[model samples]
Target: MGAGIAAAGLSAVNWEKMLQIAASWIISPVLGGIIAAGFLWFIKVKIIYRDNKITAAKTWVPVLVGIMGGVFTSYLVLKGFKTLIKLNFSTALSVGFVAGVAIWLVMIPIVRGQAKGLENRNKSLKKLFSIPLIASAALLSFAHGANDVANAVGPLAAIVQATKSGDYGSAVTIPLWVMVIGAAGISFGLFLFGPKLIRVVGSQITKLNPMRAYCVALSAAVTVIVASWLGLPVSSTHIAVGAVFGVPKLIRVVGSQITKLNPMRAYCVALSAAVTVIVASWLGLPVSSTHIAVGAVFGVGFFREWDAVRRARRQRSEIVAPLAMPKEERRRRKLVRRSHVMTILAAWIITVPAAALLSAAIFWIIQLSMR
Candidate 1:
């Protein structure tokens, strides 16, 4: 009798796992793609392109194309992982993380080359060349979806696998439905909370002319892609932030123009987010990507503005009109000021815990229901 009961339970487990994977394949990608598209659209229309006619139109086209490309890249990466590595969840996650960092480090030079190429093409048009940025953003998004998408679906996959194998285990085949939910969650996160961060990133950190923006975006994307290919689970936020900072650093080093670069502020923001992630992981809590990315943006902005403030003060002492700078330059300076940083920082501090707690709660509820 005991043997018979054990056999029956094992059979049930296997069936459940199969069902879960089946569901996930059907749902996650579609949901993720749609949500990402909608959220990106909002950013283009409401914030980035708000009043600019030419920029807005060109921006949207790339964004739409990039999102689609990202979705496809994500699907391919995940499917490849499933087919190839066959590692358990913990191992896979570890591998992914390391790979991501390595990728980012290696891509730095390539990014420099791309930036140089753009500069050579047109000095004035260099700032407005956003095409490369959009392309790069798309790639980063693809890698992001490929690696992190697992986070949303992994548990469900485990649950399914456990059910099918008649053993409670961590590694399980992800089902279609679970994939859909995870993808949907990501999409929702991007749509609802992504814009503010995007604004901070796209506009605040540095005055990204189209060309500069393209360089940053492309470098970041390439970093993520290489990482994903290496099976690394790196943070898209980190890559995006790093690339944003990296571009300016490259410009200063290569261009040698004394344009202000705020390393301190950028470090603070990136460091804070990194610390938060470590703490959260240690404490068994989920950290928000949006929080970290936004924090970095604010950091760069604050330091830039702080430098500007000092410049204004020095000018005042010399009896020169502090407000004599070009309106565009002043506007850029104001955007980076300390006050703006604080506001954005406050937002970042709030988003992570809130989103994580919400996700955890929802996950718990779902588990309980399934039980």
Candidate 2:
């Protein structure tokens, strides 16, 4: 959409915003996975692994529910209800805290009531999580609807507003019909097409009982909350899908794959990446810190390789001894992993064109339907 607008010589395309959204595509899912995995780990340690699983759940589930209530409330207030009221972070947090405590106090008896007759088995424990899981899933869907409906309708609204007013670069006013169309389309599509995807994400990827499913749902919601706090516009669908699937170790591109990173080398990469991004942003360049950081790591790795080769030659000239480093050690000493470089390059190469083609196809379909 941005590309099409730019091609038409419209000033509506915000390149910096596009770059930030692209960066979020990388950052958000990873954070979702990490948060989900961590939540799963916590549940395993605190509840699942305990001898008295029911007792453990009865003790902790209320607290978790309260936290979720708080986070969800804050997210809805700050992101979902933005037009109604503008809230500062401190005010939002305070509101969240009060809501959380209220939820905690209310849920204590409810959870206790639910858990009262349950057995100490894992199956019984799963039963305890069903309510929270269902609630979390509903909340997640609500958040997705709120965020993505705007995205779906925004361009259409802009085009309508622009065509009606003959101003292509003005603030867009979304009509009531546009909102209804976006909502109805999403609803019908999801109703007709969502089950297959639900099955795939809910079960095909991994077995999920209420307990595990709750963790994933809550993790996704919490991740979006954190991203909101950090002021990043992330895809809720991406976050939920990532929570259901797994997190990738893509950050290793700069931290490890390019070279062995000690504290000093890691610090250098971080500082250089930060400075490069700061400067680029100040200059209004759409530069990605991810790319800059990876390049810095490669630079450091190549310098280390050159230094090692030079030292090896100097040692050889001083004394013609047998190979000081074993062949295996020498092989291990290769700084950069070529496979990592190639894989990263291949992904970078395909990402833009693939996304553009998909966007074009969807836009075409929408245009045809409208006509």
Candidate 3:
């Protein structure tokens, strides 16, 4: 959520870049949905109904492997060898592409052999992808750390620079204390709140098996990579959490809320919020990052609720699926916990306003004292 809001702040800094990112975010999922559905159709036509189990697995495995290869290769190219080698961006991209293709080709033989004669090959498809999924998650964590550690370093860097040079725009030197504090603060935060955040994300927001978790992590990594390449500021944390709200909202927390979170549609939720707040900020509105994130979360969910109600109104519309599962059916299987939703919504409602008002009062008091 913190990351989401910070990314939103970039719109205030530069709406043109932010909106361009907004376009990418919008197109990515739409195109992805079309491509995925088409791929599924292709499999049904070319592989699945044909009953050639051996060929099905072999064909799909390479595609998945190649995608994974491309993702990690791109990540490594961007940041993997900066300390060891200082290749320029284009060189790094070339190296990464070659590495990805090599890996994809190498995996074909391995995955082909592994998929031989499983009774439930379809169900086990994700199982075949499991190792790669875990690898992607690991890569994502490293990529996230590489990118998101900047959230801590950025303000500190600028502050240190300003204190020394009396100019916010000066070149900055990172002090040891700043580095220690940033690392220690993150460590402490993870120790303290990490478990709960992990629990809420893994168990509540979405049902996370190894495969689904890979979806969240992989999507985040790819999104962040795109953001970086575009020079857009983003928070990996926000993107990950936002990605969860995209699709397959399942309850996994034992005894918390069996209620469902088909609460929000997968596409358009995260980017919509970011773009909205960004446009507002550009118009000189004083918006809070926390507010934008929480609002986006709720707004998306509520939109889903409304979609459930209105899904039957139009038959030929592409915007809202008229053929989507009926709202009542969705309500039973995918009910969102009212308490869980409201608690965050309530906090989002007040936190920013209260903080701003209190700070204003304190500053006024100090001014009077000086007078």
Is candidate 1 or 3 superior in TM-score? Answer: 3
Where does candidate 2 have its weakest 10-residue lDDT segment?
A: 238-247
Considering lDDT, where higher is better, how would the candidates rank from best to worst?
2, 3, 1
Give per-residue CA lDDT, model 3, range 58-111, as digits (tens).
776466446656655655655556667677757766876787688778888887
lDDT of each: 0.40, 0.55, 0.45
What are the root-mean-square deviations of the candidates from the true structure over C-alphas?
15.8, 13.2, 9.5
Superior candidate under TM-score, 1 versus 2: 2
C-alpha root-mean-square deviation, candidate 1: 15.8
lDDT of 1 by residue, 74-142 (tens): 334444556664555455445545554454444444444444423222232333333334444444444
The residue ranges of model 1 lying beyond 4 angstroms of the native Cα positions read 1-123, 180-201, 204-206, 215-292, 295-335, 347-371
* Residue 205, candidate 2: C-alpha displacement in angstroms: 1.4
The true-versus-predicted C-alpha distance at residue 71 of model 3, in Å, is 3.3
- TM-scores of all candidate predictions against the true structure: 0.40, 0.63, 0.57
Pick the lDDT winner: 2
Candidate 1 TM-score versus the reference: 0.40
For residues 113-227, write the lDDT of model 2, one tens digit per residue. 9998888877787666766766666655554455456556877998898889988775777899999998997798677546654443333222345554555455444544444
